[model samples]
Target: MDRRIFIKNTSLATAALALPKIDPLRSANLAKNNLPKWKGFNLLDFFSPNPKPVSKPTTEDHFRWMRDWGFDFVRIPIAYPYYLSIDRTKNITSEDVYKINPEAVDRIDSLVSMAHKYNMHVSLNLHRAPGYCVNAGFNEPYNLWKDNEAQKAFNFHWAMWAKRYKNVSSKKISFDLLNEPSMREDMNDQLSKRSAVPGEIYRKVAKAAAEAIRKENPRHLVIADGNNVGSTVIPEIIDLNIAQSCRGYNPGIISHYKAPWANKDPDHLPEPKWPGQVGNQYLSRAMLEEYYKPWIELTKKGVGVHCGECGAWNKTPHDVFIAWFSDVLSILSANNIGFALWNFVGDFGVIDSGRADVAYEDWQGHKLDRKLLNLLMKQ
Candidate 1:
């Protein structure tokens, strides 16, 4: 079915409650030295590293629907290999990383243009960068946190993107340097033990990339994802003046209950419950507040903070997902920190999520989670 026709036929009555207006004084303050609290979702058109069959292009209906629903931001998470000319059969080399594919880049350009056409802010993020990816499948030739060659290639890619969009206003677009920077023992093992990159190493890499980006356009805004896979804030690069991105998947037991990538044994895990005991630990809104205290405190120090990726897998019960997510959203919104859900569609989205428990609303042939959509819009 044509998504355009479907969107046109969908009802807007459920979205009538407009998003709360930004406080003028707070807006001015954040505009002066921090990032705006721009709320929206992540679009995964280029999320996969192997681009044999490119992901479906996001249509105009996406942008139109987002704007009409009161969302003003979209984070485009790209796997660097998706845009490079490389062999899928072999490990990616530093030389292969430098190979620029114009056709692949053109596809990205179209998405960015379409996003801006709807007045939505675009944040370009490298979910899979040159030398590292949090959840691994492809083999990386070198470690981004430790190898000079990998760092050089990383800067090279950021510089190329900076130069490409140098003419675009910082207000309309920003660069999220890398997604979920962390250290893992093996690049190709998804189950490898992972830990936070040392502060000095993360700082050095971020500083160099920020310099490369600014070398093209000093006004280009740059953002760095939180350390330890976006769960903790990075104090090391605060002085560099780069905004920081945080994650919303706290208490992984709740967010990734039956997900294979997050859990080694999805079938045997305890069922998730909000404000109740899951396994042995007690979870509640107070726990969530305490979890985000450091993040809120970081903002008080004048650092721009945003939740880059967040949401529960479809396997989580709908009631539990909504109940827990409500506390998550309420806390962030209260602190004036905006968030972008992990996705706009698919297993972790507000539309066509394929959750067996949800009484899905049919919107233009798409299964719309009106409950989830209403919750997001009210924020």
Candidate 2:
């Protein structure tokens, strides 16, 4: 199906504006439980700056906690480089890339099993694909969109995962094809125009990967993130029968205030306040609705919309963080969109996100933010 046609047909309908129900496919992994609105967190150990060994017991405990906390799913962002063999040279082919990373594969396999044990679904995302990653200064030797080998390697990686997880039900697991693909090297540039080039390239790559996975396991669900850090601007790839993912960090100043890594803030920017002024613009729920209009249109077309990543950075004041998160989650819930906060145990997590400014209590032997946790549970 042509993207133009999808946009034309989908834009005509209004958003469903309700949470997703459980899987209608009786045999699917999530058929019995539904999606639980997929309110969950991301497990980022593999992609963090300091990678740690995968501990089975620890992993199981995390899954257990997610289930106990009323969360439904977890997104595992795997850094592909961790699995690459140092002996291999740069710019390898798909076949070479596939055969080199057994350790990473084994680690993910164990985690996947743990998720199933606790009845928690998992989405495996290639945070660092063969040729592109959103991490700054960590440029791939080849351009993912222009390099033939990179494209082949990326598709092959998904195919490999499909074959490996062939028995896993689609409802239990999904493939978030790639992290955040953008047209320009710098991701934060002219987001609207940047969306066009990467949007088209991503469609081709995503469809190829989806086709490969479906060949091995037809029932597996595939998800693709939007350009510009999965912001609004959903590309017309829903025709591939895959779910669409976006980030929930709208009003960037509030979400990423003083966050250096994202570089979203400006010099001498005033303190970000929820529903307050950010320079000349007034940021509020109305703005959120306008930003999410594209995703709403997609959902009306029967496409599952998800916030694959969203949260306030630790640098933001705790009260402000809660306020911003509350508004974002409300917007998501009102529109029936599911989301996974940026992290599970890190700086943007429910448990021990290093926010000393907020009061915390011990729950299940973990330093838990009772207020934040309770708020999320209610949502």
Candidate 3:
């Protein structure tokens, strides 16, 4: 059956109050059935500093590349405010958010439809939500947790998506709700107590957003990212019956040695190498597992777990990234979890990760890293 027709006829979008509940047997079945082994890539261009209008043909080309490369889905990380105005000056009012940005809505529709055409899933993520972001020196004007206005904006954006794409198949479309919510001392430096904690605010805002989305369409497999850039701590919203997502970039010295946006002090960090000595200890799969143990425990608790984003920045050596990636992918697969690589075309992508040493294959006006591609395909 054609996937589009299948999605339409199945009425997969409408929902009852069936948010994920903790039933080990049921969750295990869901893991086998609903949760696909999503070998995916994040379409991150829309989240760039100066967001560009996405062309349909560009998205189609990307879908084709991903399908041809054995990937099954695309994780789209879009900044919502980019849709609010061309100049990005709109202070979205409660009444104004409901006034959907037609251009943005159409673009998302096109992206999702194209993914369905390729028989691929779409995990739509708000990398920059109304109230928070992991990027340095950037933040929304209002506090999402503390301010009713910001929470309304957050809920409004997601609810609009749920209602808009309510009929899309859960298999084909899911939500990654927010990007990495972290405790950054740099952002809003002297904020109030409640507003200061990232996890606490994330938890409240996520609950509200989840409730809003589910109200629109119940079965959306909403995914909430971990605190501190998808690291060790899972949010307290597990009881909300939503999926948990984590970042796989472990041993900062190796995975994020000198990542531009990372908050770590580069001067104090050791040089990175996979299975090489960082200090007295070697960075290996075992260490990665130790960091991942908490997230794995979440899966054991009957909520779906996915590594929503993971990849080495462009500066990391190609050989080292491949090795680290292999370990990360293997461990996630072994545990029956789905993961999406950070991107497909830019800094952290499989095709355009910008490794200085290798020759790149030009495809559809973009360069492809074939060696990395081969490594990814072999997995």
The number of the candidate with the highest TM-score is 1
Candidate 1 per-residue lDDT over residues 1-379, each given as its tens digit: 7998777656453355455767886565432227888999999999898776645457899789899999999999999999988887887887999988999999899999999999999999999888888877788889899899999999999999999999999999999999998888887776789889999999999999999999999999999999998989899998998999988899999999889998888899987999899899998999998998888888888899999998999999999999999999988887788999978878899888889999998887789999999989987
Q: Which residue pairs clash in candidate 1? A: none
Candidate 2's residue-wise lDDT over 1-379, tens digit each? Answer: 9999888767655343344555555223121212336888888767742235643223577777789889988898987766665433354444545555587668778877888889878899998887777774343556678788888888887888899999988779999988876766543232223434456777787888899889998998898887666775455576788887889888778887777766644456778877788778887778877887787667767778788998888777888878878888877776677889888776788887778697889866777887888878887
Residues 69-164, model 3: lDDT tens digits: 888978888777656644345444445434556886687677777888998888888877776666633445665556788788888889988888
Q: Judged by lDDT against the true structure, how good is candidate 3?
A: 0.72
Q: Model 1, which residues run further than 4 Å from truth?
A: 1-33, 54-56
Model 1 deviation from the true structure expressed as Cα RMSD, one decimal place: 10.8
* lDDT of model 3 at position 2: 100
Local error of candidate 1 at residue 376 (angstroms): 0.4
| Candidate 3 steric clashes | 1
Instruction: Output the lDDT of residue 296, model 2.
Output: 67
Distance from true location, Cα of 341 in model 2, Å: 0.9
Residue 352 lDDT, candidate 3, scale 0-100: 58
Better of 1 and 3 by lDDT: 1
Q: What TM-score does candidate 1 get on C-alpha atoms?
A: 0.91
On a 0 to 100 scale, what is the lDDT of residue 278 in model 1? 85
Stretches > 4 Å off in candidate 3: 1-34, 54-58, 86-99, 136-139, 186-201, 233-235, 263-269, 279-281, 359-366
Consecutive 10-residue window with the lowest summed lDDT within model 1 = 25-34
